[model samples]
Target: MIFRIVFLCLILLIIELYTFQVLKTLIKSKPALFSIQFISLLFLVYIVYSLMQFDRSVGQTQQMMFTMGLLLIVYVPKLILTLTLMGEDIYRLCVGSVNFFVDYDKSADFLNSRRKFVSQIGLGLAAVPFLSLIYGVTVGKYNYKVIKQRIFFPDLPDAFDGFTITQISDVHSGSFDNPEKINYAIDLVNEQNSDLILFTGDIVNTDAKEMHPWIETFNKIKKHEYGKYSVLGNHDYGEYVTWPTEAAKEDNFQAIKNLYGEIGFNLLLNEHTFIQKGEDKIALVGVENWGHNFKQAGDLSKASGQLKKEDFKILMSHDPSHWEHVVQHDDKHYHLTLSGHTHGMQFGIEIPGYFKWSLAQYVYKQWAGLYENLGRYVYVNRGFGFHAYPGRVGIMPEITVIELKKGVNVA
Candidate 1:
């Protein structure tokens, strides 16, 4: 732990020095420059202090969220500036080396003077994330977007063709601060009016109490014709923080599960049910939180008991890794899986139908949106709420509306 802290501090110091170089190059006013530097130092100190104050028993709190937000807002831009300046330094080194070998007079200078435009350009690039982080914390966290997806399945039940389902994931209720904004998001979910609604877990950050206040707000989500169901996410297990006792942890876990019922969802724990229409049926299977790096409570075999491989099934598994690693290969032939654990890292660029990218892709193959393998599909909702970082950037919180089409997609 001590070594990790020292390493982190060293990295911060280097980032500080490089960022300072940019400021010094751009701003000639010493007073103004010193003021900015002093403010930056204060933020650094505050971030470290706030992090130190984190209580394991208490877990996440609003202050901790603010501290995390401030840390990113302050340093992400600085890191960008640092990298940009480092690139210039590398260029300067190569030029200086070439000059030393060729011309003795030029070698006296050793290195070329830093270009003002380079510094300016670096600052310009840095401002994008700096402002973006600020906006994310202030406005983007609640910037909900309703995304519509149309997926085609050749073997889909005729009665279920064109069936619509709305999906929301990773609520992280503990991090929410704006009641009005949340209510608005709930209204948006209702506005979709899909035949079915599904919630892919992480209802609260760690404690069930975190969702208590919003229970009524979420209950506003009207009942669906096909029914509402949910499965647990890693955070719902309450394993991230220290608990007072085994009983306390277990009690918290149970309460977290009950939160789904309070919000009008059938909490499916390693079980399967059938949604029927005109004597035709499709299976709905749900499992506990199963993650490659976190929990492994989900049981595919248990969830799909008595169901045949050819049965058309829609699965609700919180983590996409469940589908990527296990479900997709299982002989049960899960036709469609819904998930939302990635939250697209709560930051990324998405241009629907054209491109989508996030840091989450490096970790989870199906980080966001739709993915398919051998006719099986998984739609990973970006998320309905923010988490550790306390905000969303380019990847706004999402409410997914998926339409099931009976025919194969041609385009």
Candidate 2:
């Protein structure tokens, strides 16, 4: 607790100090100095107010002050640096280009290039954090809801027709220090009326015990006829937290598995389950913690083991990297894979006419949402919880309701 507070204070202190330095530099401009100083003092007041945080009431306010405090600590300095450094470079480039074309100013001076310099600073200041806030509120707001959509197997038997699946990934339950918001998220999922709930890893931060208070809430979550299924995320297996020993960490993993069972989840570890939608069945395969580095423990072979050559398959692997590393190239060629680990870099944009997800560049060709290659499909969930960073920036908290509509099968 002390560390968290101090850590927050230090970064914010840096921001305060940096802002002061910026103001001090603007000493020649009385208005700039006064304005900067005034804003810094108001932020100081907020810092003082945040010191009153109590664990008892932690559930009540959503830790608004603490979250804001940390975000500002994070937001301000970066805003300053981004607005400063980025503004300077853009100013030089733009003015230099104009100078080349018009041959108006032979000078390459920073201050003398007044018009271009000021405009760059103005736009840069307004843009970065606004973009960040859009991400934060959309992703961080607990009330933000996502639904599972259903698509059928062209071969998806009539039994599973109209099967609406509620998918959640990267519910970094550890991010929340309270129950109300967590319960609210659970309630939103229940409201979806999904036939099956597939949580594609990242069940908790580092401890299964962290979820003790909300075990009741989780148990109360609504599910479709088929029930809920889950897999372990990188965070779920308890690596992020420090343990007394290796054995202790292993014990925590066992405890986590127990918690999954306790919550009524058929937690699949490198295994597959058959969703019998009549004579046509779809294989739901889940692998354990198959992510970037740490032992790619998930064997696609095991998850696809039970399938016949003609069977349709769906895979749930935590890291989207698995899509590139295993699933797409696998012999069975999974028809659809569900993953959530990317969380869309926990920030980005996707709209009707345009789709841009930064994580796609490195992780998979399709980082978030649905992507199709021939008849094969992959839908990546953007995660419902926050991690490392306290708030969401752009990638909103998601409850993806996937409606799997089957089309003509590709040979």
Candidate 3:
């Protein structure tokens, strides 16, 4: 882990030095010296911080540094927008509001234009952090904060009638130090009278202790009908933290498993169980963090062992990409799959629909909503507890209240 961190830092330091030298060579003028220096310093700090996160722990611990890094994801677009507008406004102001070339047929000096551009960029850069802070407190709160979005699966089986299932994903509990917010989330889940509670994955950030404070609230969850079930996310298996040795990391994973036991969840690691409602049978299957190109921890064949092909099935898998890539196309006739790894890119809803962009696009197509393929269905929860970013945006946190309707034709 130390070696990884040192290596990353060395690479970043080399790049930073190269960038500084290039900037020094480019800007012989004294006026723009400060801008170049400031940009170089910013790059240097970013590289240093990036290097600090290269721990053996791949989940919450590594990304924990990104609690602030995730802020960059939010502000980059805002910075671009601000810079663009500021440049245009400064251009108009300098050229007179009377529509420059068309009205007066005048061209400004190249140096003056360069100065104005740099000034605008500098102002925009400075304002980015401040604007991001303000926006994070205001609008950015929507990105990671828990907000309810009610959904009713039109064709839930009659055996699961009025089956209010509370769900949360990407908890990233490792990032939080207190239980106040977690308690509130738990209270909200309890208030819903859930027949079943499902947690998709990323339960802990990188350590089991991260969730220790919230164990009280998490254990208070009392949806006893079919009970709470969970699957491991990419974060839960000690993939992103530092330990004395590999055995120590394995112990950390076991600790998190025990934590889940305390929380009253049947943490399924590539397995299935049968839930009987009256005379009808509903099968619940859960797999580990078997995301696209991630660890192949999910084995539906093993989880579905001894189950018939025609049974009503519900799945708890971590990455929704699993649903898009594997579950939807798998030969196994799974009726419904529940997943929550996307966090909806921790961004807001889109203009036409909730289709968000950024890194989320490369993974799952139906990130935080319902999608149907042929006769199979998947519901990807946006998640409850905020992760390293510590807020919820447009997608909103979800606690689905689905009414299982009569058997629909499985055509």
* Top-lDDT candidate index: 1
After superposition on all C-alphas, the RMSD of every candidate to the true structure, in Å, is: 1.5, 6.2, 7.2
- Give the per-residue lDDT of model 1 (tens digit) for 46-164: 88778778888989999999988988988899999999999999999887887787664563667788899999998999999998888888998999999999999999989999899
- lDDT, ranked from best to worst: 1, 2, 3
Q: For candidate 2, give the lDDT of residue 312.
A: 73
Each model's total of backbone clashes: 0, 25, 18
Q: Which stretches of model 2 miss by more than 4 angstroms? A: 1-120, 127-139, 147-152, 359-364, 409-411
How does each model score on TM-score?
Answer: 0.97, 0.76, 0.73
| Residue-wise C-alpha lDDT for candidate 3, range 293-408, written one tens digit per residue | 66668888889898876777888888877887788887767878888877776656444243455456666687766677887878877766556565444455565654455544
296 in model 2: Cα distance from truth in Å?
A: 1.3
Range of the 10 consecutive residues with the lowest summed lDDT in candidate 2: 53-62
How high is the lDDT of residue 160 in model 2?
A: 64
Off by over 4 Å in 3: 1-133, 137-157, 350-359, 407-411
